[model samples]
Target: MKNMVKRYGFNVEASLPKVPNHPVESKEWLYGRTIINAVRVVMKAQDVQISIFGAENIPATGGALLAINHTGYYDFILGGIPAFVRGKRLVRFMAKKEIFDTPVVGSLMRAMKHVSVNRAAGASSMEDARKHIEAGELVGIFPEATVSRSFEIKELKTGAVRIAESANAPLIPLIIWGGQRIITKDIDRDLGRSHIPVFISVGEPVDTSGDPEVATQRLFEAMRTLLDETRHSYESQYGPFDGGEPWRPVSLGGGAPTLERAKLLEIAEKERRQAKRDAKKAAQAGGRRNPVTALIARLKKLIKK
Candidate 1:
């Protein structure tokens, strides 16, 4: 180890810029950051209110999995702002094809190199996500699949966890306190005010390659914690729940505990485990071993007599 170093910060998730060792660093990175900053400036000038937490936990450089709450569609703007101002990293989101069909916004999205996913297509979206993460770009996804209608939060989708594991990246859970998910434009038109408030919060990073299943569960749990924290923030000031109980779907999102997406999660889990085993065997065979493999071997030895 070349004198390894580690640092930590609170009131923010690990939303740091993590551009890997690639030639992509110099090209349009600072430029894109400037664009996002301009967006923030325009938003602030118009009196768009945004509260952000967990601003310092972001890593200096590497890949990361971002799990953001699906509030108003504009929450995308909020999430991207952090990367823009602080991390200086462009975020690649799983956008719908319809967004690309637009005129100006679509052109902007395509120009920025965002990921478009066909949710109706089985595991194809998963495969595309894997490729993007491998490329060392920051990825943000709303694990609820689609934004919820009421105050209710639907079962989270676990693709974020799977991607983190597959790409050996850290998972960052993001929660937005309030915003109009369905009537997103209402807030923008209402002089920076809306029925649902907007406050963005980031949580700590969860290493997914450590143990696929364990890490996935932890990622989901962390998201839930972030949600509770966000919702609680709203209720503390706003008071009285809208009777929106937490709903769930099986095996889909990180901690949903359902079976619908179980097969995919299971398949990914198996691959992660086997990948660790292969790396361990290779290391024992005198090849380089990843830290995950070394950790697993040490754990196994501890469990044995």
Candidate 2:
């Protein structure tokens, strides 16, 4: 806690005078600025460069629903960045009950005015989100609900469309590519390569009235199209996703280590260790020098001549 204060100033929980229930109130707090700036600082320090397109599509005011594809744990920050930078709107995202119940994390979530959803009873939180939207706040939802290992926009949930229709809010599609490369669910922890490029492409708001299934489909296609366009733009400027697709799952193109692959790697490492032990024991018993090292020394002596 003290280290966090020294690094990022007083904890957001301590510095705020009053907790914000709405986005408008939250944005006015110094805590909001602190968290946003902290994310920016971390992104910069990790060399995570962000590319944003179609930011003009975000409405400057009024209630809006952002439907962003979920790719990784860090994706919410990426999903919210375009809105934060362009529209200056603080997006309220609904988190699962488990996350919202965490001690430190829950405090931060409360400070940020994020809604907490009960996994078993999601409707209550959905109602809360609808109310926030009706109050003219920008609400963001990861319709996928979980990170997509395939890196492709997975099938989306109807919660976002339902919220938009209920609140009469415009549904804006947000697509983010390459965030999983920075960190993925496959590994316990992977501080990925520095200067990794993260692409965010926002699309025009879609109609939310009428059938929500159709609306959800439209949003999915829009996000898919934006993802493809962002990929093209990224590759055109930088390069391909190397020999393996940086964002895709290994089965697709992501090349992230999988459970089966990890197991094989572990076995191989154990075999190598056993072989080393066997070789050392044999050397000790026979009093034999390391042939490879002896050969290198002999070569060095001959070169001196």
Which candidate wins on lDDT? 2
lDDT of each: 0.60, 0.72
Compared with the true structure, what per-residue lDDT tens digits does model 1 show for residues 1-305?
01212211112333433443334532464336456657656565555555556644444455676788774666677676455434455677878877888998788777777777776883787677777777777788877776543333556666777877777777788777654532332122343433334556678886666555676677667877787776667557555544422222221222233343443554576699899999899788875677899899999999995
RMSD to native for every prediction?
A: 19.7, 16.1
Which regions in candidate 1 have their CA more than 4 angstroms from the true location? 1-34, 181-197, 207-217, 234-305
Tens-place lDDT digits, model 2, residues 1-305: 11111112211112222222334533656445788877777876787767666665776667788898877888778877766654356888887888878999989887787888886888898899999888877788888876665566677888888998888888999888777767766544446447777777788988877788998888888888887776667667676556565455564355655535544654676699899999999988777667997799899999999
Best by TM-score: 2
Q: Model 2: which residue pairs collide?
A: 248-254
Native-referenced Cα lDDT, model 2: 0.72
Which portions of model 2 show Cα errors greater than 4 Å? 1-27, 187-193, 249-305
